[model samples]
Target: MFNNNKLALAIFLAVSGASLSGCGGGGGSSSNNNTTSSEPTWTAGVFEPSSEFKDQCALPRTGNDPYNNNQPYPDTAGSEFTEKMWLRSWSDETYLWYDEIEDNNPDNFSSVAAYFDQLKTFERTDSGAYKDQFHFTRPTEEYFQESQSGVVSGYGINWAFISNVPPRELRVAYLEDDSPAANVGLQRGDTILMVDDISIDTNTQQGVNILNEALFGPTAGDSHNFVIRSNDGTEKSFTLVAGNIAQTPVQNVDTLTTENGTKVGYMQFNSFLSIAQPELISAVNKFKANNIDELVIDLRYNGGGLLALSSQLAYMVAGPANTSDYFYYQTIENDKQPKSDPYPFIDFEIDYSNFEATNTSLPDLNLSTVYILSTDNTCSASEALINGLKGIDTEVVLIGGKTCGKPYGFTPTHNCATTYYSIQLTGVNYKGFGEYSDGLVPSPSPQFAADVKGCELDDDFNHQLGDNDEALLSAALYHIENNTCPIVVESSSAKQPSFTSQAIQETGLPLTIKQPLYKNNMDLTRPLPAKEGNNE
Candidate 1:
């Protein structure tokens, strides 16, 4: 339950000359006092309940809400202190590793967002990476704009960092069709030599910041010049203006025939966005109609989106018999309310517009195995698909690099016009295994049952995705026919810049430059019907 008090009762009551009855969480008399001692104080390791500060804002937005059909913003009068206190209490109660957090005094920090950033655990993974790398926040309206409308301001390029460190190599992994980048003839494997005038390989901090902004942080109608070296080693300059681009979640849907006459269904899935629901359904329907022997989902660049979409995709891959059991079980902190039931494989369609269930039964392929083209970019919900399928005894042959190890998720929490996404839950499969924090590797000799079976090969950028000749796809095809991974031959093309696995692993923050806060996540905010019984 949420302490949702109207703004009128909390803020307008003062102007209306009405007696306040503790409406805005102790804002009646104590909050109205000008005395310094009356202000809320913070003691190290001590916290007041978050509800006491919920909806309290220092600079609350007034007037009609442009994002919500001219509705009033649900913000009340408070201070920055109350906002920080809310974050501390909420995070303490719900953060998956609340006990591991260092309870620093919130007053020590200058800004609310800055203080909220320090609340996560400073622990490391086995590979020395931050245990909670997914902690971040976004402007509430910006987060909803992308999640709901699937529109973003960009050049429509998914930039791949072969190396984010100096001698930094940035290349175009893929492009949304009809976008500025595609319209300018930018193709996959085209390395960006320069953004504006800053060289992509610049080692200076100022240059890196400039490069990051030029490539990732652009507004609509912004123009910049780029020097690109194509796969054929031809360099050219082009001016691209950023615009509002709607993402194409699913693309290159086709059925490929191997030399042995085995039909394989392949589709490049970029994001698990709400806009992807119908596209995914239709792709599966086509695959089912074609009676494809195997399915290959290219998620090398899919950061992740809604969890319900992940469940739906898993169901479609494994079909009813395999998905009758639980798909995933999420565990929250014990201090929070009772946990919900394990999410089962979604069999029916969902109207993502309103997040309501539909009578339309989803299409399924009933395949026992699926080939997933992965990379470190294959994160949260994408990894969920692999783990969920493996839980139900379906084979997930991962070709290419290891997945971004994130079995974590959170319900996006809103406070003071900012939506904070902290790790609230860690999800495990029906087998009770979710410890792949380092990442799920493509191994020929899988050490654990959850370790995927396939080859650890480099991402093939020289060839277009869905082409049978692409390294990852070709490897999947080879494994399908030969029942074993083929020997990986290093490509000699300069477009396929070689980087050590360690370098790639260490480039986590830099790699996420193109992807914003909400892009890489298993958002637990999707509405699902309550199914009876815990499948666990």
Candidate 2:
């Protein structure tokens, strides 16, 4: 969701110096004795079109046509004209609409124009502010504004800075199948060196801009050269032609496994889009059919999607009755009471009874443990799933890197123009006993660097760890085989408080609390704490 305060701030910056005018002026040119002055010709008030004006404005114009002329004015020209109109409308009353403005007259044009100019400036500044706030890069000609569905498809060309091991490189974390980069063989984890001819030394806005310029433009189909460093440390150059690429948000069941003679099911959730529910259900059912003893959910690169889906997945894994208990939510009270001596401050408890009553009901798998693989790419809806699962007493052993730390979500709203935009606001904080605003920390497991030289003789060596490495998987299996769930006895003084499930529902807070699991495993506690050679 877009932040309203941020938008307001942008507007303030954009129109800081603008002046306000009020009421009535002559519409026609009038002679003034003062050589330096001329009569104003517009009026003030909100620009509400008259029925006649609406009829004319609503009609679609064709072939480079402008409303005032046969040819459409350039962007720069139109902006200048709009500013002039705003000034005139603010000064003259005649410019104000008869029905819209309360104090209508000829000289109100200047006020109206001033307001309009301020509005435009506000819009421009807001756009800039939005980009900066989200660390988003401006889209170039090669970049296309994808439909909402496209974003869900796991193919959205959105890029975010992520830390990689050993010389952290600004890599392509997500690539849609239909995107030009994907078409040209760009894959997640591919280290980008140069776009067009510009080198990417820093993962800053400027670096992203260079990428946009190289990959997107009016001449989209034109070929451009890219220098990249593959995961295996080999550098290669490729000439790619830019084009529209389809994104796939969800990936179906890839494989299933059994650990310690116990059936272990594995499925990679690539995205949290609308289509993910059915796919997930099918995967889970298949695992059940296979009598899987454990499940490994890979969300290392899942960037997140619909909140409904996250809840739905939680219900499927942890059961309906437990959903509310497993997640945290709160309501914001805008009204503030004035401070006084011994002023009483009350924080109201939010009731989540309605949520529990409406969502789908399902039984918790109640597996011994759920192995969740995560990385910096896991965000939003993905984080929600993790938070929700942990809230319900489900054993989730996080493996891999710390999450991207995106707890907020957004809902889109449309304005007078059909052009819709999203407002990003903090809705709920999913504190599951462990307050996780810092980031989702993973548990330590076995770590290994591939010994490629040992398997070079095999032709399939290149494809073995082509996509995801097996180190994390191997570690999970190792623990399952050799280690029992580590139990820690707390001192009597350190005894924790436990609340009933009902209490959790009423308060929107989890009952059970525990310290960070770092004591059991150090490596998994905090992103393998930057080693001298590690790049991530």
Candidate 3:
């Protein structure tokens, strides 16, 4: 039964339902868990569209989700009480549009933790059962708090290891403006040689995990010593106190004139938190002032967050070119209503920082086309941004590798002590295209990829992301010059495929970076108001 209203979700728990299990970040779409959905063929000669996935969700029946008092929850046992509460919430609210809940039973599971573990095998993820439902209760209150406000506790360093290989060299990717790393003058390109006198690299497999723990310990405010090597090869050792640092979703922004005299704007927006809307507006405003000839958004590592901001960014990029066009469409399993609903370009002036009720006219760049930098980590709302732009016929030139392939989205529901995010809806562009379960690959074939300009380039570790000559950024600049890809390289010096990125095998290792932020607060059922004033 496909039902997701708040009341229905509650009644179901009194039934069970679900989203993606992700690593290093929190997202409803989960990461690196796509199992190829086998396109099922029907003997009846019925033509099935890409939207339906039967072969992909075929998982060997493990067990079904318990909806009733199938398991005796001793009232005396606090664990049972907690487990029951969780199970009920899962049953009540999980979005079963992709895969039905009762399909797998959890009767054999002995404990609530074990039941929860066994229960997520049924998400419809379209990639097959590889999409394990990412439903977990927080053991601590901090996680619950972070869900609502999008705030996190950590040293606020966005560092990436030099490589996944042992004897790894840790480098600072970028730092939050007010993070401890920034306060200590740790700039990008600085390498960490030691953590509290312990070497940053290890000779064994556990080396990375061990180094990670030291860098990101269990508690904030923990002081650790470090020796960092500057870009000039100068080594300086200093002590850094890891404390609660506010994460800045808008990581980097710059506007510059390229060597060819083309005005280009560059931004590396990592997440789409509510705070990002204003920051994004600020970035676009700068580009507007500069009259950028081309814009580059480096989302090579972004796992995505809010869709509202993603929509706004799309609108900002496409500007007047797509003023009346639809950014994307929402589709549900139940067909009682229309086939799909259009979410038009909302260019409202909104104070996303405060989640204000009122709306204002959003600033627009009005560029007819855009160049985006991506990798396997670019996902959900990020993918939506790419598709949304494509929907309006904006020229989308993709540089770097393929994206995380997630048109899936979710709205978080809070229970006793945990927040459950189930994949309630999937998005399609204005053309009614949605299923990129295998991800949108950049190629000449419009059937297999997004129909726009693009190149498959790797990231350059030697240069900064927004640098004029960076691997992905360079391709964008080249596209502006020759309108084609630069000669593809064997690989970038910064391309460390075997490193700790999820692009490597999902080894379930702890990461020094903060977990992903995923949420979309837009009221999907309602259509956006028409553009104000100037119809032109």
Ranking by TM-score: 1, 3, 2
The 10-residue segment of model 2 with minimum total lDDT is 516-525
- Backbone clashes in each candidate structure, one number apiece? 0, 69, 22
Of the two candidates 1 and 3, the one with more favorable lDDT, higher being better, is 1
Runs in model 1 with CA error above 4 Å?
A: 1-38, 326-335, 491-512, 526-536
TM-score for candidate 3, please give it. Answer: 0.72
lDDT of 1 at 40: 68
TM-score of 2: 0.50
Residues 43-112 of candidate 1 have per-residue lDDT tens digits of 6566788898788887787887776678888888877777878888998888888987766655556677
Q: Which candidate leads the pack in TM-score?
A: 1
Cα lDDT tens digits, model 3, 1-536, are 11111110000000133222222211112112333332122221122342232112212112331322244321221223233334534443444342344322223344445545544334445555245333444422454344335566666666565454444556776677787778878887788887766666554456656666767543576777889888788999888877766667776688868777989899998766665667888888888888888888987767676565676678788875565635444445333234543455656654433333233777888888788888766777778888877777787888877776666654554332344445556667877777775566665334555434588766565676677777778888888888877786484354544433463444433334334323222113222333334333
Candidate with the greatest lDDT versus the true structure: 1
TM-score winner between candidates 1 and 3? 1
Q: Candidate 2, residues 290-379: lDDT per residue as tens digits?
A: 766777787766766545456556656655444432333221211231211110010111112111112232334546357766665566
Cα lDDT, all candidates: 0.77, 0.39, 0.57
- Residue 444, candidate 2: Cα error in Å is 6.1
TM-score, candidate 1, is 0.88
Clashing residue pairs in candidate 1 (N, C-alpha, C atoms within 3 angstroms): none
